[model samples]
Target: MELSEISKSEIEQEIQQSFEGLVEASKALDATRYFEFIDAERFVGLNADGTNWNSIVGLRELVEPGFNAVEKVESLIFTNVRISVIDLNTAILVNEYEQKILLKGGTHYKEAGGGTQVWSKASGKWLLVSISASSKP
Candidate 1:
């Protein structure tokens, strides 16, 4: 589809929903659902751990440990979201996030950061093509 076929608001709404799905899945540590929002075949991203990954397997290995260590999600929220539509097939979203979790060892983990996600609709659906996260706030 062409850019003229879709309004910017529509694209923003789609990306917003996609981001929500990812956050919900992450909060619950549902890897399967979390991966659904990512474009596994052509994914590329810089994780919060400072590791850059070009494949889904790399992502799973780099991030799963923390997910597994979470005993409960105390809070997960995103604020100041900004979305830029590049075309009908692509959009970029940036946001600030705050997350607090209870670990299996009975310690609380808290983090606040700004992140970016590049979303693509090339495969007939919106999926994260790339991601980047900065250090805690």
Candidate 2:
């Protein structure tokens, strides 16, 4: 659908709901659901400095490691989300999130970051095509 034809309010709602789905998928480590918000055929991710993940399917492999690493975390929380719809088919979402990770010996680490997701409409659903994040310094 063209951006001009879609309502801004509707687009904003879709973006917000899509991000919530992403958070749920992350906390559950459900790759299937995670991929649901992504356009598997055209998804692309870039880290800071413009380095690509090398391949679309490579996302699963990269995220799997982090999922395993966070398995011990006691909790993950997403907060302070702000979403802006650039157009009907695109949006930029920013959010601050924290995770409380527990390790052996009662050690704990709190990780936080600001994330950006670029969403696009494909096949009648919003799919996240690009994502980038930076640690809170």
Candidate 3:
């Protein structure tokens, strides 16, 4: 899919939904659905440094570790969601989120800020291409 072919509103909605899906997939440990939103052909995930997972099969390595971590948690929440469409087929999304992890008991991690996710259109659908997160100031 090309940028000119997609509607601005559609891009906005897809971007928002994608982040929501991230939160849902994380909390539920739904690796399959999470991978569906990723653009495997050109995926760049940056948590610490530059990392590339340019194939769906390669992404499994990234997804599994996250799913495993969240699986041990009891609940997760994503709040203060804000999304912006950069063009017809690209957007950025941010949110303040928290996760309640239950291991021996329960621990909470709260942040007043969120992350930036870059999305693109592919195969007539929107898929996330990059993600950069930051801690609250």
Task: Indicate which candidate wins on lDDT.
Answer: 1
lDDT of 3 by residue, 18-56 (tens): 677777777678887787888877877655234544455
Pairs with backbone N, CA or C atoms under 3 Å apart (clashes), candidate 2: none
lDDT of each: 0.88, 0.76, 0.67
Question: Across residues 11-125, which tens digit of lDDT does each residue of candidate 1 receive?
Answer: 9999999999998899888888999999999898898878888788888886688688889999988867899999988999999988889999899988899989999999999
Pairs in steric clash, model 1: none
| lDDT of model 1, residue 103 | 95
Model 2 lDDT, residue 91, Cα: 83
Q: For residues 1-137, could you state the per-residue lDDT of candidate 2 as single tens digits? A: 54553487778887888888888888787777887888777777776445676556677777766566554757788778887887766788877888887655566788787778888886678988888767775
Worst 10 residues of 2 by lDDT: 47-56
Error of 2 at 58 (Å): 3.3
Q: What TM-scores do the predictions have?
A: 0.91, 0.80, 0.71
- How far residue 86's Cα lies from its native spot in candidate 1, in Å, is 0.4
